[model samples]
Target: MEPCSSPPLLSLGTATTSLSPHPKPIPTPTNTRLAAYYWFLVPGDVFNDYASLADEINEWWWFYDGVLINTSPMGGTLIARGYINGNIPHTGFPLVNLYAHFTY
Candidate 1:
């Protein structure tokens, strides 16, 4: 299946963002300049029953091994390309990919 097929919820792909020693706010469609363009899956249903996995990731998206990364207007894109496979674990409560696009 294509990345964009499963709504905006998909495994978060690897991205290039700065990791700071502090906790940063979550990026949205506005305000923050981060952009999660691509959403991918983890091939087969490796963790189909690991729906709760996304919650953990969402809670610590800006954290790398416990350290928080500053994800504000740092340029480039903020792609959450790791939680795609387990996004559709539950129905209705689908996770939508937050893609922030800027035009200035």
Candidate 2:
């Protein structure tokens, strides 16, 4: 299987905002799931900070297993990917391929 080319669309919640300062917040389109996928260019310090955060989360989270951390083939990039497999808290259905990604 390949990594996802884009983020998954989640219908969690919504918020409204207006373009101008004086106008009231317009209820633009609600109930829309927006997914944004792009590459972020960061300075060395910021990159290091993200890498450290990923490491710390992976280490502290007991639910993670077989987490993979590496760089892209082109170099100068970092990829941290993993998945969680188990049953939902009260549901007996098997949960699989629930993955997470951290890249820079």
Candidate 3:
């Protein structure tokens, strides 16, 4: 991914929809320690096989900070949950300035 001048902004206004019912929150794992492996939800219909998906991910390897794997749960599903390192993007500065400096 290209270097961003600012952190991405999350807009909640359009996130929730009145047309459809809200989705139940996914249960958070109890042990949230840092890990090397990351998970991603790949749609079943999108790829013909796992190799194809792996190839696509490999093609755009630069965009990801770490590697992606199917783990135990992936298995060609419409919605697969994955995990990633907490340190993606190398966590630098906050998007917004917490305090402003005034010139005298």
Candidate 4:
């Protein structure tokens, strides 16, 4: 008789980070008739495969996101938005970010 062998198991994990650069100087809005707030939504996608559990592994890759929101004077609403992609080559490694903001 022969002994049975055990099969290997696999596992996967994911992580995310945010980066906001300094906001350029802009004219301050002077409107109090309405409330104001802003929200920057940046979408970054990750496509990688994990290996079976054996030794812990950690690596960083290049990814990008955009900021989209309204100015403080604009009632803090979402207006025009932009994006970043791999095409925009960055000379840095995995942990980098930038944000822009201003209020009245």
Q: Which of the predicted structures, 1 or 3, would earn the higher lDDT when compared with the native?
A: 1
Better of 1 and 2 by TM-score: 1
| Predicted candidate 1 versus true structure: per-residue lDDT over 27-92, tens digit per residue | 766555342222332343233223333443454444334333223424524433333334445333
Candidate 1 — which residues are off by over 4 angstroms?
A: 1-49, 58-63, 69-77, 81-94, 98-104
Residue-pair clashes per candidate: 11, 0, 4, 8
| Model 3 lDDT at residue 57 | 44
lDDT of 3: 0.35
Candidates by lDDT, descending order: 1, 3, 2, 4
Model 1 earns a TM-score of 0.18
* Model 1 lDDT, full chain set: 0.38
For model 4, how does the per-residue alpha-carbon lDDT over 1-104 read when each residue is reduced to its tens digit?
A: 78877764763335364344975579877863432112113343232222211110111111212232222323333222222222233323322122223243
- The digit string of per-residue lDDT tens for model 2 on 56-87 reads 34542433354442333332223322222222
Clashing residue pairs for model 4: 19-97, 19-98, 20-97, 20-98, 20-99, 21-98, 21-99, 37-76
Worst 10-residue lDDT window, candidate 3: 94-103
Whole-model lDDT per candidate: 0.38, 0.33, 0.35, 0.29
Score candidate 4 by lDDT. 0.29
Model 4 / residue 62 / CA error / Å: 24
The C-alpha TM-scores of every prediction are 0.18, 0.14, 0.17, 0.14
Determine the backbone clash count of candidate 3: 4
